[model samples]
Target: MAAATAETPTDRMPILAAVCLAAVVLPLGFAGGAVATPAIGADLGGSPTAMGWITNAFMLTFGSSLMAAGALADQFGRKRLFMTGIAAFAALSLALSLAPTILVVDILRAGQGFAAAAALAGGTSALAQEFEGYARTRAFSLLGATFGVGLAFGPLLAGFLIASLGWRAIFLSGTIIGAIALLLAGKRMRESRDPHAVGLDWPGALAFTAMLTLFTYGVIEAPEVGWSHPIVAASLLGAAATLAVFIAVETRSARPMLDLTLFRYPLFIGVQVLPVATCYCYVVLLVLLPLRFIGVGGLSEIDAGLLLVALSAPMLVVPLIASQLVRWFSAGALSGAGLLLAAVGLFWLAHVDPAASGMAVILPMLLIGAGTGVPWGLMDGLSISVVPKERAGMATGIFSTTRVAGEGVALAIVNAILASLAEARLSTFVPQGGAEIRAAAQRLAMGDVHGAAAILPALPAAEIHNSYAVAFQHLSIVLVGITVVSALIVFALLRGDRASSPRAKSPDDTGFDSIKTGSAMS
Candidate 1:
């Protein structure tokens, strides 16, 4: 409901509070279901392959819907979109918690992602409009801090909730938190909209969404469904076609959803791609590592969650001092260096035996954390810097879309690699069989360790474990190679790029000087 007819001094604190509270959704969307996926499948009777959709659906919709939401927020009002998004997301979460089948959850979860797009775009744009100078810096810093806190402890919260309450409890919690945020915004937010805004670019939005959805679907489904399956091929072809149409649509539109001209700046491209690449690595590990601890290391959920403190806790502390580090080294150098360090951590992960102790995992985890953490302030500054002030909204949209979509794509790639490689290895272990062996192999590739064991003999189960390890190590090596290569490429591209964080006061310049003067979190 409309609360304030005009901006008032009282609106500032409530607006700030709403922005921070809304940040809770970020980590919940990113890391919440990871620790609870297996439990979700067990409770809901979904196949392992189908369960992958839970994350994919959310990611696809969230990424694809974000830019469009940003555009609409300008045309309508930020507060309106923000409150609507929070309300819809809360309702969806409650519905998700009560769903009797996986089909309903997947569909509703995707809806939640779309709802989240509105919240993210509106909440951030509202802050930029409402606050200025020193206060704006503090507000955004607090917002980023809340986001980091969510990422740092989300898994632990999931662990305890899954162990003590149930998988469904998290959804209920999401609903409650969202409702609280909605109340805060609805009571005090001063709605504002641009008078020069025109109608939305619906065709561009549709084409872009189709492109991402088709491509992600192809990748995620290819391993289980077979690489050359007609549907997979069709999906991939459809993705390409949709991408071409999207470009064509954007080229002609007066108000395009994406400004392809942004690609002109190599530095801008690097800044945008940096978050995508880093988030790709971070989300993959956050999901896969806990599964590794459970399936391979035989740790309980709580224990596995506790181990992630080494990986995530640094995200909280490092950002506070990261700007100082950036002063000594350029943001470009720090970003590349951080990625290389992450690659080293992955290399160490490849060496971990299934029977390795807690300390063995902890050390490499700590390395990964510091590696990922050092670039936060610089990244925040850099992403904002490369774009003009007039396009601040567009920059935020691009930054968020790439980051979310990258995580989704990375997940599909990881799952495909694991499933395909593991399946190949399993066939070698159990060479002579019909449907039973093939079915068991499918289960193994999906990391359903116990289910695969239940189907095969004890000796074959051990072989399946060994095969899983080898396949996982191979995937880790691939990740290392990708990270190392990306770091080198970026380093070369930014050869003379300075370490300074750009500040924005006028409409011509844009950067997170606030992040530099304040705390940083990516």
Candidate 2:
């Protein structure tokens, strides 16, 4: 038994390595759009709306499939499911690279999203099952660290690759990474199958997927089409109905895709909600900051990327300190503090103008980063801590789903708000349809400084600067409100005592102990 317990982690190393490699692909694939959007549009003859779909499609599928894949991982063998996912993803990456049309690319992007969901759901669960106590905590910490690193490096790598090779090279790189991950997984990964696990809940999976697809589609399109549009209304109604059906089915099914009963625990529910709000604020700010720098401040892509480093750097370092801080502060406390800081940062950002230095703009990002950093590990730990080991996959699935869904919703909201404000401001500033006004409007939309500069030859420089500043101020107010609301939610939902003790055994200890008892289990 002792030998078997000791060997479990060794057997798991290969799969973990494969997971890490597969994980990088997600951030890379998602971030590639930021750098390659202009190039992709030029090549495909698509507009910014098409570009939005490119990323939105990926996120929607990724977020929607998580719970379904988690349940699948629980039903199937983790290693087998994980490898299968990577294989599918690799094939789709190649397809995306070779796609003849933007529509085809969108379809392939959706496929990639599904594959990623499988990999993430199966890999995270397998890691939890394989490791014990301190090792498990360390493994999870490393996972968070890797995720942050991937996000930080993805855009930079995409910029370099897109500059050197065509945007196709981004997909090509994914193919290589996916292939390597598959090979390593096939060779080194060990199967983790649960003989007594329930059968696949196909009905539940389908319903959940449909619901998310409708909701995501509705949200994404709402910005272009009015929310009251018949299609948008129908989509929203369909989403609600599908979700209702999903719940009803889960309640009646022998084995549900998501065990709704788990949410009864306050801690479990709180942890999930906390991340949703935090993630919404985080992604919105991330999206807005880069646009602000490039559009109004007139920084280059490379320069904006570097300035953004100040925001991401804290994420890398804060988690390490967070591990220790969790010993002193409750997860709720830390999370609430983080949200407050983020809100304050956004409020400060609202005051920045076209004349503000890069350093000044970056200050708010730094504050937001530091505030957001403290809750990273604590939230994950809290979510899974309350779930039984058998349900770890499900818990992780829900956790991931909520986080990504929040991100999508947040981006949509921010985009709608900013678009409306910018349009209104633009109309006020440039009433006529002249070349100079058209040029200024376009520059403001792209966040390009050169276009703004060109307009100065015809229009007053101060007026151009004031218009941009006014638009940004409105954006800041919304962001600040989001942050503050998130903070309040955290305070209300999270318990003060939940993170007080480090010695508390998670709910899954019994299942984990049982697994430790059997030699074949590891």
Candidate 3:
């Protein structure tokens, strides 16, 4: 068995570096969308709704391609697929920078998402192929840390680039990073391939993609078009039908894109669910925080961005302490506790009125940040630990797809809730006979604060300000309820026992040895 052979320090160096680079670049592509929203909207002459399609386009493609890309990684060589993905992503970024219209930019963004999915799926699978047992666990932790680093820094980088050179420069910077990483990867990385990998599951891929596309599109548009609209209703119904077909196909296929049998492992299933719920809660908070600080609190854009530094500070601090916590507590306990803390933090945030200072909100943000960090690190490690090495690519893909789906749902739900609340609230204020107030409230609800000043003629300044403050407070309560529900779901899925540790087997254990031998043979 390959497990019996000792790995020299040099043998691990190249793949480790490849993993690090892949981790940083892939997430940067996704995170860049969040900060570039305002600039993109302004330059492209699109409203907030159109700008949202920027993310929706990328996320839909990215999430949908995961399983297919993972299968490709297993069939072809990981290094080859990864380099191809990086090159494609870099080219797309360059194209996006040069795009003359919003539609072109969005198309490029979708292409970039496809490239990113390939890179992430291939590169992370390569990491699993190169390491095992405690080494694999540590490698996954470092991968999580790298992802956190990207999440923490991507916005700050985007903000700086936008401030200095405009939004075009942001895509240019991504192109440069992707080019550099591609060059480094080509120079140092070795190939990893499985001979036994079955032919491409085209029907499975198409069915799954159709299902995800319909579902994400329905969720994304439901807030604006109303759930009962023909398009929304069709999308929702199509998604259900497509998903059912996908499951039936997978069950019958000789080589399924997703081996549904994996779900039979309760521990593995529980571990995967942790990230889904955590990601949903985390994205919801991230989306809402900027609005709270800048839109309602009346801070400058720069100040609001700076305030986020408090929320991100823990990403740096928490990784150093995470391994220690894992040693002392089970992943389930740690994850559940983290979700609980985040819920509490969200509840605390709900009580924050417009008058609250940055200091008052900073603590809760920090707590939520720290709490979320634990599960973020544990999730990938736990999911992969229980799966066979040959299935690592598929497992990681599934876990990632689930996490992104959770994010999409979170964004959709929050947007729906906020839109509903804002409309309901606006109706009450509109009846009070202030046209200016009604328009300003409508703009705020639609996430169009830049156009807000144009609509503030029918009311005094004080009342307009008060209306926004009240709306944000109501939105915070919705976020609080979301976190609480998220916590409950996580707790229910996670088993309480420490004995369920995914990485419990030692390097010499048969379970570990078998996977390594099977992977090498394949």
Candidate 4:
């Protein structure tokens, strides 16, 4: 790793703003794309299979590549890497806006996601290094709040912009904001790196990436192509083999990219996998709800965006609230409670027909939003808080990877579930169409009603609508089941664990050691 170097005086304001903006943009990229999916897909003539890829490809590459990028930030310099990531993210996003076809956009989105990994890893490391004591906790809370705001506001803003300016405007907006963040971050943040860092583990990185990619691909394609398809079987089998190799390599490596030893800590294991439950529900809904609103309710884009506030607004407010509540309740309490609330929301939502009124969607979303707010903020803070300052890079790596991977997998699983159900219900409606009706069901799951209808002349609109309504409830029940079971599991594992407990504090707390009294942070 490079030695720390002298730099210009650090300005916390600009650094904070830049990191917040970067975090905001990351989710904005996802949610905005979700808001704009129909327009983008329609223009690109994208099939349902390809439509999912527009978002999934980015998430797959981003989630898998994060650890490698985080390690590189530790080896090189975080301040520099952070700025470079911002710049690359801007360029790639701009390239995405100009892409003529959906395929090109998907390919570039993955590249942008890869670049975003650096921003995420570097930004969190910089924060942990610069802030300390109670102040560091405050910073983490604010950081989480800003992240929620970005996610919450994404649909609202993207809705307006896409309505007036078109879908490409969303990426163009990212390009502009990223440029501004690049300059601010470059001028304000100080340089730092891990002094004990060794060479990169290229083999481990490849194995890790391949494992996640193949597994995600298999799950996403299963409903469309069938689980027994040779390609799907190969992908899942390959993922398993690669996972074993990754674990073996990490256990043996002197300087592993991902320290599997961290799993020994039960709390770490619980907190790390928390995303699998929360995001598995949250992100899939983020995709499906918009589709339901626009496709079934026939709401305008702006109306749909406004409706989403019921979900994301509570998420935005909860972190700031959680930061203060830690004085009364433990992070684990808030997290577990949040999951239970989410389960309740899911159960409520499961009963709502797809053709239900807007209020039907809004009420459960508020409950889910409030529940979501509690955990994400604390879970994120704990991820870094649990580890020593030196291992912040690794912590963020695993943390970000888990969250994004869960999101991608959840989206895929939901898509598969809905598609499978759609096909089953639709088969009765279009019995004569055979395989054509089956393919149409996949399109239905991807939120492509027109595309699905275009494939079969006899595809009854009533049948299509009923199929989706049923599919949504089935997926919601699946989510409810998972969230409740997960909440119970976490309660069992993390019960009595308190954030205020000294046990929760890292023995190698960087807040006391990493930051010096005043001047600048280098």
Model 1 lDDT tens row, 188-282: 77786655557578999999999999999998878766778899999999999999999999999887888787676566667765766576456
lDDT per residue, candidate 2, 1-522, as tens digits? 001222756676776677778877877687655555555755886644565677777877888788888877777877777888888888898888888888888888888889988988887777767776656665666676566666666666666776677778888888899998888788766666554577678898889889878887786665455568899899999999999999999999887877787666555566777767666556655555555665666565556567767666676777656655655555677778887887787777778665566688679878877777777655665556566666777778888888776666666556665655655566575777344554454455445545555764655767666766777688777777767876777777666443422225454452212111221122
lDDT of every model, 2 decimals: 0.73, 0.69, 0.69, 0.78
Per-model TM against the reference: 0.90, 0.85, 0.88, 0.93
TM-score winner between candidates 1 and 3? 1
lDDT of 4: 0.78
Candidate 4, residues 27-116, lDDT tens digits: the string is: 889888888888887788776777788889878888888888788878887787788888889999899889999999889988988888
Clashing pairs in 2: 295-447
Cα-lDDT of candidate 3: 0.69
Higher-lDDT candidate of 1 and 2: 1
lDDT of 2: 0.69
Between candidates 1 and 2, which one is better according to TM-score? Answer: 1
Candidate 2, poorest ten consecutive residues by summed lDDT = 511-520
**Cα misplacement distance, residue 22 of candidate 2 (Å):** 2.5
Give me the displacement of residue 36 in model 1, in angstroms: 1.0
Local error of candidate 3 at residue 194 (angstroms): 2.3
- Please count the clashing residue pairs in each candidate, in the order shown: 1, 1, 0, 0
Pairs in clash, predicted candidate 3: none
